[model samples]
Target: MAAIQALQALAIDVMLPALGNISHDLGVTNPNHRQLAIGVFLICSGLGSLFPGSIADRFGRRPVVLTCLTIYVALSLGCSLVSDFTALLVMRGLMGLFVSGLMVMPMAIIRDRFSGDRMAKVQSLVTMTFMVVPMFAPTVGQGVMLVAGWRWIFAVMAMLASALLLWVWLRLPETLDPDNRQPIMPRVIVGNMAQVIRCRASTGYLLGAAVMQGVLFGWLNSSQQLLGEHFGAGEMFPLIFGGIALVMAGMNFINASIVERLGARRVSQTAVIVYILIAVAHLISLMRGEGLWVFVPFITASMCLVTFIGSNFASIALQPFSRTAGAASSIMAFSRLLIGALLGTVIGQVYDGTAIPLFIAMAIGGSLTLALVLYSEKGVLFRRLNPPPLKVKAG
Candidate 1:
């Protein structure tokens, strides 16, 4: 899960600085159109999660992930050579479609091995490990752009995918048992997904993470513009973004330490409340026309709050449906990525002169997340340690 999640994080941050150059070179007139190149990949990743799991169950997780990584590499290199915007978008979408195995299989592997609170603890630890990559990817991407040019962003991604493929091919063991392996029947996968969705608590975290992911994804799609154009910090964008990412990493580390004791629900609920408060404050500051000095601090704080929500919510959701982890993970990831892609599109559309659009979207997403959590838990803000396993309902 850690390695795969790291790959997912790298997908966005590593190409960020290069986006400007690509837009100029590709003859993209609107800034929003440039954002679509990134958005399409995310949307496809969401859509891609629907397959591959049942395939993994049939063919084996190691083989499926390896094949996907190889395809991701080929498509990423294809992205580098594309001459037109449509071609680049198509290649990116293809890259996303293939990378779904990486996104969903790690959790399945862990589920194949672990259960209960042990799974949550391991998930938190895995999340912290992967958090390090995004923390530095922008910096790495910026360095690559400085030395190798914008095309080299894809080059680096291809190289990383190559390396990961080699490692997975060699090191990963097949976790799916032959007796339990499900055929790649679309009806069976969709039927399993429906069962996962009907479990109220599990669906709550899926929606909660969806809303939160939308906020983060919107910020990611717009952060470069928000910092460079709005705040007059073009040169400082990577540095500032990286610094906030590190703060988020620190918060994830803290979550790893506390989640086992405080439990996932308590920590996540507190984080949501804090996230909303900080987002509102940031929106107000932007409304007042203050610059980085105002926007940077609150944005950083909101990111800190985000750390509390992300992994713990996944841990809680995954806890109840251990038997169905593969299917459940696929559903949860699909919802999260789809919401992110849609919200990101809306945020990209509203890119006015300042960061207000971004901030407003973040605030709204965070508020919705809070409401979803409350409603899901029947107004209970915290979970009892060893809370009852989520009730799986007949679809």
Candidate 2:
């Protein structure tokens, strides 16, 4: 499941180093236009997941995942073959549609097996594993670029999808029970989604998660430009990008270890507070004309906090639903991707050869996240809905 999720990271991060080449080869002259590749993929991926979640709940996890993987592979191949930018974007949108299944099914499977703190722990572990891909994907892209062209990157993705398809076909079992199968109908999906929204905690946390995800996406859409254009990092881009991802991965691992004890609420809420502080500091530093030394670390810390918040938020939001896991996952994913993609595109487009816009976006996103979390919890904070298991005293 971690490997399957990593495919999404790989598709995005691994292509970072090749964006310039892609723009040059595809005749994209405007620098801002190049970001469409990432933006379109995210939008399509979010929209595409809308139905797959319902389908997964109704049919089964394994079949839905396998079918989507097949489509992802085919689309990857199509992306590789497309010569025009418009055609490539169309293919990317389709690829994202299928890739949405890769995301939703795994969470449904996890939700089927665990809940509360244990579920959060499992999610953290999976996220830690998933983070490994982004940490190295840029380096991998650069390495491939040294030997081949940008198109080979898509080919590599296709190959990876094909391998994962085989693995799932052979090994993954259908986790959705026959008795719990939801009917594939619009009314049922709407009802389940409405149920999720009516639960204040779920809705609030979902919105908070979406805002936090927007911060991450905004960074991603602008990272290459930020590092390469503003800081003149040049060939060091992949290394620096990977280093930041490594920090996030380490934080996720730590969160996985302590979440069982601290509870998702305490950990996530605390992280959001800290994240907001970091964002404020970042904005101040930007206004004060701080250089990369000050800017980079603050931004990196903010990103780590985002991971902490995201995992916990997701676990908390989905805690209330067992039967509606698929629909819940879909709604959450869609909201995050849609909002994140829009925020990211705006941040990318607003790049003015300076760091101010990015910092401003981060600050706003952080503030919104904090507000959403407070609203979700109804002014109460740091209290766990599901506390850790009590330890018995040894006689």
Candidate 3:
């Protein structure tokens, strides 16, 4: 389950080290315009996420995910053959469309088998496996670039997606219970999504997740440039980038261990408050003209804090509905990716060859997320509404 979801991460991160080469080969002269390569895919994925939930609900989890993976694998290979920037972005957008399943199905599948704090704990454990891909993806991309050209990076993505495709086909059972299946009509999908959106707690957590996602996407949009050019890490960029991912992976592991005891709301809410404070400290250092060494700790700390939020937020948002889990997960994923795309594009475009813009975006995102969380909880923070069930399954 985790490996399949990580395909979405690998798709983006594996191309990070090769963005410059893609731009040069495709005749994209403006550096900022290169970000479109990522922005377009993400926005299209967000837009496409709205459709798959109903389809999965109507059919079954295994078939929809398998078909999507087949399409994703095909698109990854096709991307390698693109001769121009326009063609590449078009392929990316298509890949994003099919690949939306990679983000939504896993959550819906988890929701199928677990709920409450137990669900959050299980989600964090899933995240621990998921985080490994991003940590090594840039390094893998960099390694491929050394022997081949940028196009082969897409070839590598194709191979990785294929492996996950094979694994899912052989091992994954349909987690969605037969009774929860909804019809494929547009009204059915829309109505289910509407119910999710109208719930105050779900809506607030969804919006907060969206804002926080924008902050993460903002980093992905420019991290290679920021670490390599702005900070002058040069060839060590992949290692530095991977280091931040390592911190996130470790935090997810911690969240898994502690979430069942401390409660997801309390742990995640405390993390958000700390995230905002770290962002403020980061901004202060940026104002002081500090170097990369000084900024790394603050940013790493911020990523650690955010690791607590994503899975927890999703678990909370989906807690209210069982029959519409697919639709609920889809809408939540859509909002996060779409809003993240827009905010990430702004952060990338406003680069100005400095880390100032990125940190500023972080501060604003943290504040916005807090406000949304407050709205979700009616201005209260860190209160756990659901206690762990006594006889939960231990998967």
Models 1 onward score TM values of: 0.94, 0.96, 0.97
Off by over 4 Å in 2: 387-395
RMSD (CA, Å), each prediction: 3.5, 3.4, 2.0
Write down the lDDT that model 1 would get. 0.80
Q: Per-residue lDDT of 274-295 in model 3, one digit per residue for the tens?
A: 8989898888888889888987
- Which runs of model 3 end up more than 4 angstroms from their true locations? 387-395
lDDT of 2 by residue, 227-309 (tens): 97788889888998999989999999999999999899999999988877877777887887877667679878988998888
Candidate 1 C-alpha lDDT tens digits along 119-169: 666776787787788668888988988898888888888898898888887
For each candidate, what is the lDDT?
Answer: 0.80, 0.86, 0.88
Higher-lDDT candidate of 1 and 3:
3
Q: Please give the distance, in angstroms, between residue 179's alpha carbon in candidate 3 and its true position after superposition.
A: 1.0
